[model samples]
Target: MSTRPHLLYLAWGFPPAAKSCVYRKLATANSFARAGWDVTVVTLTEDAWIREQGVDRSLLALVDPRIRVVRLPLSREDIETDIRRFSEDRALRPRTWLKRHYQQNVSHFPEATFGGWRDELVASVRRVYDERPADLLLTSGVPYTFFAPALDLFERNGLPYVLDYRDAWAIDILRDRPAFRPDSPAGLYEARLISHATEAWFVNGAIRDAYADIYPDRAQDFHVVRNGSDVAIGTDKIPMRQPGPDEPLTFGYLGTVSFSAGLTRAVCEGWRIAREANDVLRRSRLEFRGHMGVGANRGASAQAVAIAEYAKHGVSYGGPVAKADTAAVYEAWDALLLILPGGRYVTSGKVYDYVSTGLPIMSVHEWDHAAAEILSDYPLWVRNDGVEAEDVAEAFLQATKVVQGATVEDRLTARRHAEQYERYAQLRPAVERLTTRFAPGLDHVEPVGDRAPKTGEDVHRETSVPGPHAKGERVVLALTSPPSEAVRRSVALLRESGAHVELIGPDSVLEELRGLADEVITLQRATAPVKVSPSTSVTRFTPRWASVVARNLGRRHIIGPYVRVVGRSAGWWLSARRSPPAMQALKDATVLASLDDSATYLIWNASRLNTRAPARAGIGATLEELGLTRI
Candidate 1:
């Protein structure tokens, strides 16, 4: 037997991945190692991270040396940085090609983009398992795709697994609904995977409630292991200095760059409120640090858009804050902005960080967010219950008053409130519990994770499931989307009439619109394609789309005839010869006019929209005019 109980930690975005999830993973692994367990993390290789978020070993500073990380040979080909490796087939129908390939990849497992890594992940875990037995396997998922390897291992070894879902697999916390259909393939995967786990961990109580609602039967395994404040906080005994007569109030936001609807709207509105309401704050500067989004959207993501819009508000994004500089940055700030997304269940990892700082905090998220819960007793919080500019502005003004009036007692009080949330402190009990469970019947076994697990997974599922779809009629709209108002309102009335309205969306999308679809392919991005052979669908065309459609139309072999390709206009068309075949193929393709205008089109022509969205819908109508819908 191993000298110490061996705990297998599976997290794709481990330290050096440069993803936001890296911090949590690092902390969790380090926490396990600190708790006397031998932690073996299974993640992607160094080169693989290079093509994705790029590498940053700085996060490993706090990592335990004893913890072993197995970097598998896997790179997300979707984010492949090597342009020279593109093939002719991959070039022509780039959009369609990736879509089709993505589907097939998921078919091999349950995830889309990373699904192809399934066999390798399983092989890696199994290889480790064979070498030395695992007492517990804790799998963290943001790339919910990481669950497969763990689930596959359970099939053979029956090793108890843990699902460390930071956000959640189901329930769009923002809109608040089932993340996916209860019956969809993705939903099926979630049900089974979560059901068998020894523990299902969530970042907050809200997320825990959601899982319990979805999988009540396995309610016994649920846990609320919050994203805690780091225990290794700044060590200066010196009291935070007061603002100088000449210096302005410097407000700061640290960690991940984000423009999530809730985060963006709240912060900007609050900024507008602060700037306009307080003469002092109008001169105050807001600086944001940390990456916006990982993968392909590094600096140019929606978060970037928010920062750009707030540029005139004396807010500037100086870039991501270095881990070493975290404490000093908070010390420099006059106050902090805690802009977050999600309602009651959404308490970000940053909340603890913000709480630990002596700065006054102005909340620009929901009144119910878990972050709000953390700040409930905090003296400096000026919570903005609304996202509107007026309400946010008032909240900002209130924050200014708090900053100005703050006493040493106030700062000490804030720090005291946050003491328990220290990353290690928050994790201590759970770590002990995990250790005990893995080393079952140990006198050291402790009942930890104060939140109840009795409200399990199975109970959550049955009550949360939307009623069965109405009887279907032919010619109804096909959908496989996770519920969203855009889709819901589109088919609300139709669905009410028993028309088979399918919703095709990913589980990451919100689920409030669950009742709007007859059936949903809830775990896949709608933009993702299902592979189809070229010979399967005919290309006969007539009507308005004729000239454009006929020239580019071709039958897809996998996703079926209803699906068609539209060019991804990434950049202005390159000289066909200079461009890769896929870029050239985009030039030759008759993508719907609207699709040609999208961000994905950047590969083909970054300046223009794909133009095919409305065009495809239009083409369908035009075919009805010719009475030739199909070849």
Candidate 2:
């Protein structure tokens, strides 16, 4: 047998998932392989990813050929949007069937949707371990179910493993709240998993602190392994473009357009307002290049609809950009729009990519975002205080000025600032530390051949020429029901700002608010409740009793119905589906402001429709959650 130390990495969202976590997964595997360890990565199959988030074949190219990747036949049932794939029972009552499926899964494993994969994952790890005993096992998790297999391997063979939490399990990032109570099953599982883990890696200091606070004893074991940019794959040679006075500045947003609808609207409206206020902004274009949404909605999400509607206002969606084409995409843009949601817990993977580009960055997120910490020293960063249209508009103007005034020296300064955050730089030390501490024999092994040059190095140079800037103000669409005082004030404010505001509501309401808005659209109220399939329903206590009795009597027939009832209740509680007109308003609105609870709820639902854990909140609470005091 070879004397090389073996490492088995378990990452559910590895290559081809096209998910946000794939970059870190790719980097970790490659880092281990280069460190002279025999690396084996276990991940879900491409077909499984296709049925869920879809696959990106381009990502496969980024994986090091020397590292072995084993594809598991695992897929998520919840994200399956194809109705044709549903069984007869599931088709009859989709919500109920799904609930029961989740219940069955969680009963076996702590993770709800992915709990069912416990056996397969355990078997896969065991098989790999039997083939060649692994010196180390590293598991990255969103589906914390990976812990079960890792724990199994440890208990069975005394193998040491590290827990890599890309996102925390017990903490909710969006709400900044504890996702599970300390006494909950998930909480218990996390405690047990961490108790035996050699080390726990987090994406940022904030997340590490969160875990540290929860488990004070294991605080020293936690480490921050930030998601750094891959210079070899992208961000190698810096390209600088300076727009002339008459030329239109191209502001580009790269990565998935998966933020809240309110955030998206704010950025679009800010661009609109900036264009109206500044000649330079009016002639500019903001292009979004990434996967629009997940599952069946894909590019046809509300975000895509809004982008299509704003086509006249210099907003365009160029679809998903390939991993190899990332450099080319950055070269095409004059500046970058960094739009992300969540407060301290959310440090997007794209921020490193943006910083490495050495291009001017216009941030469209809360001031409290972790990305702010990283970009604090960046030379050409234009940050917004809040998500309000006016603040965002001001940021757009500032970014335009920065891009116009950018010099070669300024670009070089920005690139130099990002040098510390390259993928290899971040991973090499972490891998070296792990080897030295745990597998000391592997410490002397150098990385297999010279790796690609880091960014800011003189290699594969490209010259960029200045482009022309385009100009014009954007149109605004406003939707109101009874026209409350808040709505009236908001409408008046938009009109005073010189926006071409259009109103859509009841005829009487529109007539009452006619002078406040530029155009009025009258909508008729529905006489009957809108009947949508998979209708929301309440679960009765009888089901709980029935479940208990069924368990005692060993009657699976009773168990299925009880589980379905639980699922139906959960579906009703979590569903954020909206009416046609409300969706239309979201699609057309340059900026969405809600005065009343109903309007706010509608907008909030639309914004969080695709989110994994969509929460219901009033306008004030939703705005507060987004780090905005007002819109």
Candidate 3:
């Protein structure tokens, strides 16, 4: 074995993926390589990304040439949009074919779609161990199945592994609650992974807290490693430009527009409302410049359709801009529109880049979102209190004023505020600490001289500003619709525990739920759906016979001979279709959760509301877990 310490990194979304996660992945690999460690990155083939989110060859230029990249043959079969590639059976009954295929795959592994790749992943790890013999393993998750190999390697060779969780496993980011039941396969796997992991890294505190709360015994293992902007898009590189009198104050949104359709529509509607009300907004355009969606629907998703519909109302879609051109794009814009989905757990990776731009940002998300927490001290931020058109319209108007009146001093202050979150500043200290812990005897690597000032220690000292309602000792229960019997039972339990409970939702439901609670507040409306896609419509309103036919066709007894023949043929076809595994690591890993139920959304909303209260009990098991029940 080589004397040098070898770090094996398992990240599915590495460079060339062009996905948001690539920035962090690239930084991670480069950091390890720069630290004098032999870094090997295991990720899916380029063709896999090309088939799914598409690739950005320009991003590959950023990768440290010294670091070894192992591309696995894995690809998401579910996202294959080409009709010609589908089997006759799948072509005829796509939904049924998918269901059966998923069922078969999940039988082998816990993850529905990704379970089949477990064996390949394990084999790859074994091969890498036999050759290079890694001293340490670091796995980033979406396909948390990387833990399976990490566990395998540890059990077999006693090699330690660290989990770089960019996003949560059991905890749902969108809804801000437990994604799976504690006893479920995903939850059990997560518990096992965390229990064995030497250390667990989270992108933010909310995620860290969620994991810590779930596994109190393993709480000490979790570390906060905030996702910072790329050094390439540093504040220094971005040219600050004030809008001239003749030039309209252009508001730009530069990131993937993959949030919920409702959120996207709300932003468009808000822009229209603002434009109608303000002459400045009417003259000024709101340009959305990024990947609209993934797979076949890229640039034609519900979000893109909404943007197209609102094109007449000063909203324009500029498609995706390259990472290299991000600074130039930001410089052209006078202000930015920060539109995101979800509640407290959803701190967007784009926020760092937006902050670094030093431009006035109009927020179009929930008031209690984690982005709001990060941008609280940011000077040029104007947030919409609600998702309603009028609320967002007012925010747009406010942002317009901020942009028009923004002095050079104001811009400078914004840049100064953002200085703390520079990519290297956030990453270097954490990387150094991990390196010291794992490879103590190794000499400390010199800093990347071209990067920003070494103020990571200073930035680390600054504590996060508490939320607006952090001081308020009141329990707020927010619901999308009327409370179910289970929700009512939970509410009664909360009251019995001496908690001051206030219910907030639409006026129609608030009155009905009022008698069950101490006080009621109306939110005026529920979330409205944007344009529905054909696939969604079909899935939502599929005929009973169609399911019956699908189920029947999928059974072995109904068409045993045909199934046997097709299964063998399909297996061969799928194997051939999958790209060859590069560098002989893992070819497949498992996804954490499938999100099959509406209950996930409900639990998320309840979880967000629970965060405001001292007791922190909104859901059924959550109440019991927190021991908030009346004795």
Candidate 4:
């Protein structure tokens, strides 16, 4: 094996996955590769990618050949494809089963769905370390689940590690508050994890502040790693294309639509209001492009729902603006909507592309979003923090005016503002910082992992029989509509799988189920139970507003009571066709039944207790039984 320092890079959504994380992950990987380090990237397999934000191999164009990429055989059971693969459990009770499953996943780790990935990720890292002794272990996360793996190595042996906290896990930057309680298990976990890092990287300064407050002593280690734009992706062969007189202006947004579905809804609502308030907006066409969600739920999500709702007003959904095709998407639009999260703290990767495009920009993000720091220099931009229909409408109005009336001087000014955020400029410094400044210990500490000479791409595959019946695994009971059955059953499984599920209600109850449940209430219009069909699959593409379907079932616990807040915050998630809790709950019950009820329902059973889920229950045995094994 070569003696050059080997960097074991852990990025869950590397190039091949085509996830929004791909651009950052690719940039980070390539930076290391160019820095004279042997890079081995560990990510989920292609099959899993198919189920979430379907893959685009072209995204891998920028990846360095020197970088070795490994794919594990893992598939997110949450976003499974092939309806034939659905267990009877999913087909019968989708929402309840999914909630139970989500809970179980969180039980493994604070992050739902990703929590179960801890073991696989740790094992994979161990194998990678064993095959080639890496001089440094670089870790990046949002699926904060990656932290578990990174920590796993730390606890076991001594090796230097760098933590790229792309987005804070426990801190809700948008709300500018701790995502969970300080004394809560999550809070404690984050505190412990942050305590061990040699260095921490955040996309924006706001995030750094939040971390400093969390770990006052290690404040200096927490560094800023802005989500800058890619020079390769930002460069346009065709420069600014002006709209013809009388041709309605086209406004565009392109990026990974993951996380906050609420953001999408707010933007959509703003789009709807603008069309109604101004003839100019009504006449203009809003073109949204980029990966709209991932997995089997692609192309159809709350974001899609917003597009559909505003389709009448000329807002259309054009799926996936490729990294190579980013220029095309930007070129197609007359203006840009910089929709982001976390006031002033969250500088998204899309901002680099937006400013680089030199298009007139409109800010649909938080009034204090970090991108504002980048765009404040641009003369032709409008920002609104209220997220009110009126503000979005006004932004729409301003963008329309810029697209139709801005002078050459204006366009030149916008382009100039984008010059600074080139991906190269942002990533190179980071590569150097971690290389020179990072070390592992209580402070600048070394990591822990089994030490042995290891090299090459090492992706471990688990043993899971795939087929119609999963090769005779015990058949699970499933029920359609009114999550009472599904939720109740899921609780049983969660308790069985190891979550401390406590039944809070009676065995049976009836209530109406409705669309996009704002709160965990009874099913709206629970007239008749639906029959099981063989056509459901975990990999199926659902509509954007799938919460409407889940509402038909009584189960509605995964999401918070604030639908408007979540909907506005989750715009990216909606567009990406990701399995938002708003939709996943429904999908869970749907898939479980399709597979002959081979699922565990928690919320449904808990409803029998006529009580809410125990917020105190942390990681326990209920995990496996809750379908967490599938996520």
Candidate 5:
């Protein structure tokens, strides 16, 4: 048997998979291997991801040759495109089959999709352990079911494991709230896993802090291991181009095009507005290079459609960029458009690479985003105040100015700013901490199981541990807009606090909020359609329309801008007026909260109409009003 201290790393999406998480996964495994630990990585077969997100062969070259990769036979059945592979049940009742499939998986373990893989994962770990006797276990999540195997190993053989949450589990990063009630099955599983783990790792501080609050006693073990750039991967050929004054600039966005269609439309609209106002921008090019969507929707997603619509205005959506070609892609661009979704919880791995490029970078996300936190000190960044078209247009103008004025010194300074976030630098401290604490042949080191498992219930029962919420409280949450991470976090806290919550939002989100809310009042979209001129009319000319348009072209153009502005405001007013349940809930609510600006006007109208309840603009304000802090 090998005498080296063995680390069995359970990563579901390790490289050759081409997912965003692969960068961190590669760096982490390599870090451990280089630290003198014999690293054995367990992951799904590359064909699994090939069937889903597709794979990049270039990433496989980056993997450390010393690290032993054990590919699992498992694949996501949902993303399978082969009709021949479909069973009779799946083919006949696909929706019902999917629901039942998820139910079966979650029944085995708390995770929905990968829970059924628990047995296979545990068997794999046991085999690895029997062969090499792993001293430590490191598991990255989503196939959080890997935690099941980790828990099994810890319970059965007194193994210590670190839980690396590339994304949060119990805390939903997208909704910015608890994913499920702490008492729920999934939450309980997370609690159990955390209590037994050697340490818990998060990609950013916000997520780490959120989890720390949930399990205060374990706060010391929670660490932030940010996903930093490899620095060397894409900088091999940083070929900087210096275009003459008359040359049109090339602005590029490189990443998975996964944001909402609304955001894409705003970007295109912003590009159009910028071109109309600026002579240089009119002739400039915006290239988006990344996977648009996976499976059947590849290149046909709503965001892809929006980008295609602006093809006449110099916006083009190229396909995915190979890992090796990343530097070359950046070489062609004068500036980078950093477009990411999610709030403070999400620090996309792309941001590090973008900043390292030393190009003029423009932020196409929220001001308070986690990526912004990293780019705060980056000198050549153009910040966006909001996701609105006007905000994006302003950012574009500012970015253009920055690009025009940028010099070699400025680029060098920007590149230097990113040195601190280089992959090994961010990861080294965490690795060293683990190395020292779990030094080889340190017989005094305590087994994780020696400490009793502390479940959420056990913590709740402790008098020293304060409860999440007060009793006999009814909070009406007006998430009239699409639910966001920030709002979702608040909702999770409210539910956990034992508050009776009445949730009012669009009908589409009812399924998502089904179990979380006490009363879900869904406001269906208005059925009445407004007659508007077809966009196709600009292409196909009709004789009667042509004469009418020619007669009042100047007058219509003058008034059309004003008309559209009024219509948008009017649309919001109309949506607010339709919800009586929302109004009544606000009146009876102990605390009324609006999650986003979409419902800010509704809350304002409600406050004036019935001033019984204290109205707050956001989840943070509501939490403060109720004197409830994360415990």
Candidate 6:
């Protein structure tokens, strides 16, 4: 065996996946390689990402050549766009097929989409271990399923492992509540992984505290490892130049456009208001450059459509920039638009990148957000009280002023403030701590079968943040419309009263409801069924003549679109009946309600099926039934 200690890293979204998480994952693996560990990365194949966000081949150039990467052939089926790849059932009843797929997946492991990869992950780890035992293991998540194999390895071979939650799993960080009950499958799995983990790392202090509150017993092991600016983008990119007098400013936002359409409208409305009042903004054009969405939804999301509608307001949507080209994108802008979703638990990865440019940043999220905390000390941040159009308008006005007046020294001060958040700087403490604990020649070192290193010094921990109190109740509310002020108020009251709120709605509004509800379930609507292509394996199940006929029909312009429209209409009608998960949630609900008239049918059926839980229409009536409010 080689003298160097071997490190095994399990990251599903590793490069060239084109995910924001790639920056952190790449930096981490490189950090270990630079520190003299023999690094091995196991991740999903390029095809997997191709079916999802698509790949950024440019990112692969940044990987250390010495690091060995094992790409597993794992892809998410639901995201696959090729009509030929679909099975008959997947093509015809997409929603029902997806529900069944998820049911089978979560049965094997609690995480829905990635849970089925558990066995393959275990086998991959075993193969790597058999070749040369790893001295340490690190698993990053979105697919928290990777933790399953990490824990399995630790149990079998006494391998010490780290859990890097770029975002918390058990806790819905965006909603600021437990994602699932402690007794639930996902919760139990998360708890088991944490208990056995040598270290648990979160992107920010708020997220760390959220997990710490849930697993207080393992509080000592949790650490805060913030996602900092990628060196490629921060140091390599030229700083934005201050425009001369009367120059038109370019306000830029570069990140995943994951915020809701409502948020987009609020921003555009704010931009319009600002443009009407301020000359600088009137001349300034706002450009949002990023992946608007992933998979089949890319470039066609509701947010994208909303942004397009605001083209008259000096706002435009440019497509995603390459990871290597982030600095170029930064250099083009005079000020940064830091638009993000979620409140206290979300400190977006893009915030560090924005601050690195030393450009004036306009905050378009909640005042209490974690990102706001990072920008608190920033010299040129234009603050907003909330996402309201009036607040956003004021922020735009302030940002225009900042852009017009910011001097070279002012920009330098902002950049200096962001220096502490450099990628390696944030990761150094965790890397160094692990290196010391797993140092090869230490007297504490023992045989692979018996190794259980003493708990290392607590690297970092924050005071536990108070979590939602338990009201010993669960409310499952079905919504047909995007949340209004009343719906928000009702959910807030439910959350404050310690009830777990699960909002079931169409995919279009799920993003809007995510922040208000503890759990948001998308009520699947079937789209046009994919026709089997004769060239693909799915064609094997159908007769050759049938495949040819279907292929021809799919090619006919009129037939294809008409079939799709019919499929969608049928899907919408069958949606309520086919929602097995939502139905089960309703059955288990302590109370049931509908937020709008369109949702009454689901609530009514749920009431009949779940006779014990009080079912009501409208938020006011539901609150009255729950005795939370009197009307």
C-alpha local distance difference test of each model: 0.61, 0.70, 0.68, 0.59, 0.75, 0.76
Candidate 4 local distance difference test against the native: 0.59
Candidate 4: list runs displaced more than 4 Å: 81-83, 86-100, 103-107, 234-237, 241-245, 258-282, 293-297, 341-344, 437-631
Candidate 5 vs. true structure, TM-score:
0.70
How high is each candidate's TM-score? 0.69, 0.73, 0.71, 0.68, 0.70, 0.71
Q: Give the Cα error of residue 428 in candidate 6, in Å.
A: 0.9
Model 3 residue 476 distance off true place after TM-score fit, in angstroms: 55
The weakest ten consecutive residues by lDDT in model 4 span: 613-622
How many steric clashes between backbone atoms does each model show?
73, 9, 3, 125, 5, 0
Q: Per-residue lDDT tens digits of candidate 5, residues 114-223?
A: 88888877898799888877888999987688888889989999999999997798877766777899889988888888898899999999998888889999999999
Regions of model 1 farther than 4 Å from truth: 233-239, 244-247, 261-266, 269-273, 309-312, 440-631
lDDT score for residue 308 of model 1: 64
lDDT tens digits by residue: candidate 1, 244-340: 5445688777766543745665577678776876778888888887655444344444555566677788877665555545665676678888777
- How high a TM-score does candidate 4 get? 0.68
**Model 6 bad stretches (over 4 Å):** 234-240, 440-631
What's the CA error at residue 65 for candidate 4, in Å? 0.3
- Tens digit of lDDT per residue, candidate 4, span 1-631? 7755688888888866766667788878877777667788887777677556666776776677788987877767676533344454553355555788888888888777778777877888898888886777878887788877677777786766778888887777667666788798778887777788778888878788878887899998888877766546434223555666567777887766664667777777788777787766668887776666444334434566666666777877665545665655565567877777667657777777677656788888766677788888877777675776777777786677677777766776677777677665677666776666532211221221111122111211122323212221222122222343323333344334433211111113222322212222122111222333557533334662354456435222333333234332222222112324323333233111111121123223312232322211111112222333222
lDDT of 1 at 550: 33
lDDT of 6 by residue, 47-106 (tens): 887666657776887887879999999888766544334454554455677799988889
Evaluated at residue 84, the lDDT of candidate 3 is 35
Error of 4 at 496 (Å): 45
| Rank list by lDDT | 6, 5, 2, 3, 1, 4
For residues 1-631, could you state the per-residue lDDT of candidate 3 as single tens digits?
Answer: 4566799999889878878888888888888888878899898999788666566666787888888998889887776643334556664345677899888777766788788788998898788778788889999887777768898898899989999887887887897777789898877777778888898998888888888888999899899888876646443446556765556778899987768777878888988988888877778888988775555344445666677778788888765666765766776788888888888888888999888877898898888898887899999999888988878888988888888888877887897788788776677877787788888877778575436443322121212222212121244444445654545655665566655556544466667777876776454211122224566543533685466446445443444455355443232222222323210101121000001121122223222333332222124322332333110
